[model samples]
Target: MDSPVDNANAIVRRHRLSTRLWHWLNALLLYTLFTSGLGIFNAHPRLYWGQYGANFDHAWLELDRFPGWLTLPGHYSLALSRHWHLAAAPVFAFALLFYMLWSLTNRHIARDLAFRRDELAPRHVWQDIRNHARLRFPTGEAALHYNVLQKASYIGVIFVALPLIILTGLTMSPGMNAASPWLVDLFGGRQSARSIHFLTAFALVAFFLVHILMVLLAGPVNELRSMITGRYRLPKPRSRAVP
Candidate 1:
């Protein structure tokens, strides 16, 4: 007979409280960034490709009139876009910094959250994929914290996407860009940076869609509780399953 504490450990480790808070807060910040970004995009109303970008004649973007109830026009204000973006930047930065620092300090950056040696095995990956496809969940065996796919996605967003977005954002500003010509040099030029920023945003949106789908497939209530409470409820053991 195990005590309550023992049982708790066997089933689920209560997630670190910090993880829960940071996760939701980051979600909020990301939403703000996304909405304000749309406003900014609407202001420009065009997208360009290649080195030499958008001229007045090159209109690759389109916008619809705001609904009459909204009492707005066909366009968004550049000033308002700048204000919202700049205002939200610090909050977004702070949330990311805190999340990264906490993850590192907590020793949560382990093989369990990263890629596992065995995960690269074709057999194992195939088995897991089959289980997921069949709705036969792998609560414990699939990697309780994070599987290889999750780790790769998370790391990419943290390192690649976040940095690219921030730098390109700064590059768009005259004052910031003036102080740092290397920013332009690294990304090729201002228009290039803008293109990169837009592409990265699209990637993130795609990632979010996949993420939400996975969460739904994994059991939304359980996933939501785990994220919110920092604790996941483990499935009950079955007699036929070997330890």
Candidate 2:
């Protein structure tokens, strides 16, 4: 027999062990990739859409070089930046591949991240949007499953955005280009691929920022604890009045 306090505080296993490991590992790899990438970008702050681009050429997008504090190595070194970026690339790619395969095999994607038909309705989506805007999060058993918006975002990132980034990255690689000329053609050119890569990176960054903000708004300590450990404390259910 559990008291009200005990029941409210009861913990549930939310994430699997493999999912927890993958989450932290992905976080570390993404941090290294982003900082190192910025260091590389500092060397070339302009983006173009063709095979060749230089300081003399006009760029569709341009930004000032990022400061040392914002980059890996903490100094301007294109060579060092490339070294860091390349070193992290294989691990990140492999981890993503492994995670996707594991998730599919375990049916975690189907079980946890899949959206129901009703959730895809315009009315339902609008409701979810309004709920999120109002900071009205799911409680109790509902907390165990991701809301519709969360499912859509996660699916998009995992399926579309991640794969596009990887493909664009390979398109920018000289060795990869040599091996598969089709990649360059697919993206239009190296510079185009670079532009796409930058866009995708920023998209991921935006996602990360929103994710952190949501966690904070939802209860950072509880959210962080769930990811750090497998246990999550569900919000207590609200009582409803009967007529």
Candidate 3:
């Protein structure tokens, strides 16, 4: 892998095939979880601000319309939601297990994804915010593989929100809840679990929005190609006139 400075080259060091598969599978599972979770909420059909137990008039969210087209005769929305949520849960769990094992053994996980010590520095984060705000992406040799901020956000979503969603979701089921009253208490209550689920949903969506923005800023062709082909193509070198 000669440096582009030393040789005119088009090299590829793209994502591994397994990594790409995991990425796509994770996207599908997330989508399934989101829609099914929404469907489950359709039963209760109400939302409130503040904690779930706290009495409040602020019913800030709801999906009032049962889209007539999707509504099937004799089909229970709640049951359907439960079916999808439960079905998708195992798949999502398996993916996480694979990811955890793969990353733990391969060291690439720690090196590539984990936030570095310097990344947490206030000055570094501030610079990232300013740069991202202005849409000034890194370029050429200075081009970051990924800025420190991206690493932190990804790690947070994986470690915090994902586990919280999984645990809180299970707390809603009576049988599971019976066995695990501790989980209910951990989240505050059954209603509180629902509330946390909603909050985590919003956070995931927010992360998705930011992720897309970063990709667009990073150069779509480069980023997308790497994800698909497993080999990123570097920019073509400018031709030098023969002396």
Point out where model 1 deviates above 4 Å: 1-11, 50-52, 57-75, 140-143, 237-243
Instruction: Kindly give the stretch of ten consecutive residues in candidate 1 with the minimal lDDT sum.
Output: 65-74
Question: Ten-residue segment with the worst summed lDDT in candidate 3?
Answer: 65-74
User: Arrange candidates by lDDT, highest first: which order?
Assistant: 2, 3, 1
Candidate 1 displacement at residue 216 in angstroms: 1.8
**Candidate number that wins on lDDT, 2 or 3:** 2
Clash totals for all models, in order?
Answer: 1, 0, 2
Give the residue spans of candidate 3 off by over 4 A: 1-9, 48-76, 141-144, 235-243
Which is better, 2 or 3, measured by TM-score?
2
* Candidate 1 clash pair list: 15-230
For model 2, the run of ten residues with the poorest summed lDDT: 1-10
lDDT of each: 0.68, 0.89, 0.71
lDDT of 1 by residue, 134-186 (tens): 76655443326565456678889887898788888887777887798888778
Query: Which candidate gets the maximum TM-score versus the true structure?
Result: 2
Candidate 3 vs. true structure, TM-score: 0.79
- Residue by residue across 38-64, what tens digits does model 3's lDDT show? 766666666653335332455656557
